[model samples]
Target: MKYQIRHRTHYRYTQPLRSAVQTLCLTPRHTDTQHVHHWQLQSPTPLQPQTDAWGNHSHVLAVGAGARMLQCEATGMVETLGTPLQSDPLGPDPRLYLMPSALARADDALRRSALAAVRGVEGRQAQALALTALVAECVRYQPGRTNANTTAAEAWLGGVGVCQDQAHVLVAACRAVGLPARYVSGYFHARGGPELASHAWAQVCLDPAERRWLGLDVTHGCVVDERHVQIAVGPDYAACAPVRGVRSGGGGEQLTVSVEIIPQD
Candidate 1:
């Protein structure tokens, strides 16, 4: 299937910004599940872009005019394809090793929630997958219910969040239980079921015990397959944002955003 995507993000500040810096992880990477045929980004400001350590395309955009909006508009054409056995999964294993920054964020609630998910599982590996399902059952997928700072324990407590929040909760839960997990920002193809939305999910590595990486969307209650299109993997959302920035020269500014994802027939 082919898709055309249009995304616009705008920012308005109370005061004019002399300069602005931003990181953009909006480009999709071709994987076992998807391919990017064409993509482009139009920024109101010029940028210095680089790929982050976590594999996200990063950017630093500067603002010269102090009174206009800061915006990013992008369009792309992509194809969702099938996975092949010869292809390897992206990122590191979770069951093997997880860093302190990643694991330290877990609280009692996160641990308990994740543990509860695996309590009924028969196998360790399958336990992780079950945990994913538990999270989906626990939280409602409603965008604008939470923000980036909203943690796993918070979302678990609230029982709702968007894809990013869902991934955060699951990542925190997985890491708290000694699983090596990372955050993933990407696109998903829903086919005839639903329209596409900018999506976020989680991945775990099995380390030496099992040489495999698994992708899970707690919000969707399923493992990522050919319909999934991944863009970045990191310890958190800060590592893989479609567009992030601050402006100093703009004041009393109004902002609007629109994101559309549709399947091409």
Candidate 2:
């Protein structure tokens, strides 16, 4: 399956009188399961392409003084070619994912939750599925209840969050159970089905010897397949945020993002 993805972000500031710098992780990666056909980015400022510590393709955008309204757009075509379940995992230190970040911190509550979810699950894949389902039940998909900085324990207790929070909870729970899991930011192409501009999921290292990672979408309670286009992977959302920036002077900024993923013929 091939998908044409478009993501647009607009920033409106109440007062702007200086410069801005941003880092973007909007480019799809070349993995065993997916390939980037063509990609392009549009921003008011020039972008310097660079790869991050986790091997994600990133761009650094810098805008000069006197910039009020800023817009960043990314358009690309990605082909999901192979079986995601059988896909070869990219060689990275799995321990990095096992280590918890602030946003994915785990505690006694999460550990108990993990133990409960994996009870009687025989294999890693089965445990992953069970945990995904548990997370789906634990966290209702409710926006505005949490923000990007929401921790896994917070979301687990709150029982309501968006995909990011759900993914964080799943990641934390997997780590608690000694399964290496990471956060994945991507686009989901629904192929004339329900439309979502962008999405987040969790990936677990099920087989260390085989170097295979299982992708699970806790939000949708399904295994990630060709419909998923992965862009970045990290311990949590903070490391893989699509856009992060520092500005000298921009007050009371409002951000709006629009995303579209259309299947290509």
- Name the best candidate (by TM-score): 2
Tens-digit lDDT track of model 2 for 100-210: 899998889888989988988898888888888889988999999998788999999999999999999999999888888889999877667866867899989887777
What is the C-alpha local distance difference test score of each model? 0.70, 0.86
- What is the C-alpha lDDT profile of model 1 across 176-199, one tens digit per residue? 766777788877777677666578
> In model 1, which regions exceed 4 Å deviation?
13-15, 82-97, 100-104, 119-124, 142-144, 193-196, 207-211
Lowest summed lDDT window (length 10), candidate 1: 83-92
Pairs with steric clashes in candidate 2:
none
Candidate 2 structure lDDT = 0.86
Tell me how far the alpha carbon of residue 145 in candidate 1 is from the true structure, in angstroms, after superposition: 3.8
Error of 2 at 30 (Å): 1.3
List runs of model 2 lying over 4 Å from the truth. Answer: 86-91
In angstroms, give how far residue 160 of model 1 lies from its true place: 2.3
